[model samples]
Target: MTPREYCKIFAAEARAIPDFGAVPEIIPLYLIYRPANTVPYATIEEDLVGPFERYCVKERDGSLAVQSSSEIAQKCCAFQHWLYQWTNGNILVTDMEGVGWRITNVRIATKLKGYQGLKESCFPALLDQFAAAHRCNRYCEILGLKSLESLQQPAKPKGSKSPSLGRKAPSAQSSPQLQKKGLASPQGTRKGAVSPKASRKSTEAGEAQLAPKHKEEGSC
Candidate 1:
């Protein structure tokens, strides 16, 4: 599907996704078009401005090489994985780009109805290689996207996260000795909570890593 249709469906499906409060919102907007001489219309999108910056979440071949990738970019990668499993591996949108999480110019590699979407980028080999190409990120686990094991075994959504085998999740308790040292003060955040300073530091590192363009991997 074109970005026009794709963005619409993406917004609808994304609503069910857990936002984690702090992650940048994925607000894919409409694709505006203008009349063209040869074609009926020319595809165009709004230009991003100011301190706002564009980011590459994943390459066309599904490489996540940006080691310090922003949380938003990492989240976007998980979105691609979720989309793949949501469609039963029929589609894996890649080459994602946008300012913040307001994405555009994404390429969809689809194997639905025997139709290979995006003739320029979607190829048979790429489809088979995706199982090896993608490496699940922390966000992927948070969203419960099943790891891609093989081409024949298409991943299906594991749905909302729930304990495996009915086992309880680890408690967030801390030892009294640790609390005395202020490592786990009652007034302080629970485990996994990030401080404002640390969050900003991570964001800066991720933006620096994203400054360079991602190299093309494989044929896709």
Candidate 2:
């Protein structure tokens, strides 16, 4: 969904919750699942279990709470129940492994944050849980937010070049080269410079040249 639509969903859901006051500053969390990779059992225990224990301790004092989707599911009984309701039991307890449960929780948490005064209720521990589960640190960079020291910027997708950095997206009339490449005469150029019919004929001639060579090889 578009960012604005995402924001709206968060607002509506947050308002529906009892005792969820004004919204907090909402940040969108994008979760990408990578289940094919082997999970390092030691790393998972250290990273997930360790901090989770600490988070529960902090929650008792009202100083920290879980905010992200997965953490929220783990921490809040109400939210866990809500998940079952929302998914119509498609996500059973056994199905939580490698599932993006935390991503959904983070979305709900952020929406609640947008309500009048719920940011404090949503704790940093929760945000951390969301970040860990869904790798939010990388997404934060895409949205131009702070990057975690452990997180590297996501690679530019293969064969997909970004438009020049700092350049605005080009409009139809913006690039003369693009106009020429599209076989449209550049605006105000000489008539002979670009002829649509001639361009078509030239393309046909080039294809013909390649075709005869292919035919000759087949015959040989």
Taking all chains together, each candidate's TM-score versus the true structure is 0.49, 0.19
| Per-residue accuracy of model 2 over 1-220 as CA lDDT, tens digit each | 3323433554467567554444322234444455676752322111222232211112344333334443333423232223323433222111122122222212233223333344433333443443333333222232333333233245576785667866887788879787778785556477547788899999999998999899999999
Model 1 vs. true fold: TM: 0.49
Which residue pairs does candidate 1 place in steric collision?
none
Displacement of residue 70 (Cα, Å) in model 2 is 16
Candidate 2 C-alpha RMSD relative to the actual structure: 27.0
Best lDDT goes to which candidate? 1
Predictions in order: lDDT: 0.59, 0.38
Candidate 2's displacement at residue 124, Å, is 32
Query: What lDDT score goes with residue 8 in model 2?
Result: 53
Give candidate 2's total backbone clashes. Answer: 17
